[model samples]
Target: MLFAGIDVGSTTSKCVLLSDGEVAGAALVDMGIGTAGPERAYSEALAAAGAAPEDVACCVATGYGRASWKGADLTISELTAHGLGNRFLFPEARTVIDIGGQDAKVIELDAGGRMANFVMNDKCAAGTGRFLEVMAGVLRVPIGELEALAAQAEKAAPISSTCTVFAESEVISQLAAGTPVPDVVAGICVSVASRVAALAKRAGVKEQVCMSGGVARNGGVRRALERALGVPIVWSAQAQLAGALGAALHAWHKSEGQRGEVKYG
Candidate 1:
């Protein structure tokens, strides 16, 4: 049976297609059409799987834009999906930290891989990808190049940015002060990482911290996070697709119901 998961996030939307609990295909895209963006991602992913929408046994929509998804069998919140995806990827993970485009979430997992407690920063974009994008713009470089420069920084400067607008001003001031581009950019990473760490602390972070979402792909942020949290992080090839993966898991359970197979939460 084929199942699908669609994640429409603040910055990007992703969809995953699964066949018999294995990934058949996935599609990623920037949110263009507001709520319909998730549905588009779902359609693209389904096409990548060489399957039509009707062929999917179930399609579970997730993320901020989940409500916009049309033709989904059901919809799940990012909190549940992130927990589900993290547990599915790393059964040992006790904590999950996800930094998306507009928010950062810390999820504490129960022994059964359920969400025990969680905290999120949805009101601010500081700990998310938008902050990085703004800083990268100030540095006059593409977002992709900021990571390399951040990695080479000799010393990260201090950036006090509790908000994106304030952070932009600080970035400009640093540039005018001749603070070294790498140092400034790396400092931005550090600031964001600190915010994430603080959020994780509030949620009672546990060992085996698993970082997911697209921001985890950032080398500077990852390194700073490893330093601030003082623990090793668990990441995988599917790190960026946690929500979509969780949706796929939900689809699997739905398909299992059709087969009358017992499944665990």
Candidate 2:
């Protein structure tokens, strides 16, 4: 039987299909929450798996917007979903860091891969993907180009503000003072890393750290995070889909139990 997981995040929606303990299909949509993204992503994932929605034996939902989707068999928190998903991808991982469109989180995992402790920054957008978006706008560059530009920086300009508004002003001033765009971009990455590293430190850093969510795809942020936390960060191409994968795994487990199938660890 097929199991489905749908994550309705703040800025994106994702769907994952699991068949007999293996991922059969996955889809990610750029829109989320109040939009039609969840359904669209679910449909695309079904298409990818060559199956109809009725084929799914169970469905789980997660992320900040999970409550908005009434079709799920169950709902899980983002922290739990991320912890499970990252552990599934990297069994050796002891810590998980997720930087999404609106927030940042650091989760510490126990020996058995359960969530031990976690710290989240949802009160501000300063260190989140939204911050990067604002900076990209100020630099007149696309969000995708920020990492490549930062790679060419001779030195990172200082951005001392911890507030997004003030940081944007600082970035503008730096550019007005003739600071290289690359240097400014590098500074922005460092600033974001600094904010998130503080949270990681509070949660207590551990070896074998895995980064998930969309910002994990930013090479500049990844390098800066590594520097700040004094550890190498591990990630995968499917990092952005971790939440949905975890939800799908949960669905699989629930479905198996209902079918009276022997569970696999």
Candidate 3:
């Protein structure tokens, strides 16, 4: 049966259509940048999959804006959906780290790919995309360019503050001191990776880790994380879509008259 999933995130929303166990169609769009993008995303996914809403046997909704929409046959946490999706993509992964628009998470998985323990940071904007965006804005550089500049840096400035506001102040100070933009950008990447590493260590991070999230798209962040983590991390090909895909999978199972919650391990 066909199923649908909508992930309404802080910065973007995504929709996925699952045909059996595989992704048949998907789309990612900047949300709140438009109206009811979540519902529209679902409609778009159905169109992309060449299926009608009636063809979708079930729908599951997840992410920060899940509660904002009164859609979906079921609602699940992004954490649960992400964990299941990552495991499905990389069965060997024993640890999962996801850094989305607003927060970061370190999830520990057992050999069976089930969630063992996890920790997150949601109280502040530190170690999130917003933090990186703020620094990019202060440096007068785009987010995509920050990575290239940072990778060329030989020296990274010290950003003592973890708070986004204080860190922005530090970036401005460094720029005023005539510090190279590359070095400043490198520092921010290092700081973010370090912050995430601290959380991973707390959760007892292990090798064979699979990282999923929009932030994983940044190469500089990957390098910094590799250096701090001292391990080559693997990322899912469908990293950003993992949560939504998993939700759709759950939806499919539910529509099969299986009332039991499908747990991924």
Determine the backbone clash count of candidate 2.
Answer: 0
lDDT of 1 by residue, 1-265 (tens): 6788888788788988877667788888877337556767777887788888777888888888787777678999898898888787888999999898878899999887778899988688788988898888888898988789998899998997588888889889989999989999899999999989988888887898999998888889988998999998888667778888888888788768532221221
Q: How many steric clashes between backbone atoms does each model show?
A: 0, 0, 0
Model 2 accuracy (lDDT, Cα): 0.90
lDDT, residue 144, model 1: 83
TM-score of each: 0.93, 0.96, 0.91
Candidate 1: stretches off by over 4 Å: 32-36, 257-265
User: Which consecutive 10 residues in model 3 have the weakest lDDT in total?
Assistant: 256-265
Off by over 4 Å in 2: 257-265
**Predicted candidate 3 versus true structure: per-residue lDDT over 135-182, tens digit per residue:** 888888888798799888989888853689888888889999998888
lDDT of 1 at 193: 95
What is the lDDT ranking, best to worst?
Answer: 2, 1, 3
Q: In model 2, what lDDT does residue 152 have?
A: 99
User: Candidate 2 on 1-265: residue-level lDDT in tens?
Assistant: 7888999999999999988777888999999899999999999999999999889989999999999998899999988899888888888899999999899999999988789999998599999999999999999999999999999999999986389999999998998999999999999999999999999999999989999999999999999999998999999889999999889888887777532221222
| Model 3 lDDT on a 0 to 1 scale | 0.80
**Which prediction has the highest lDDT against the true structure?**
2
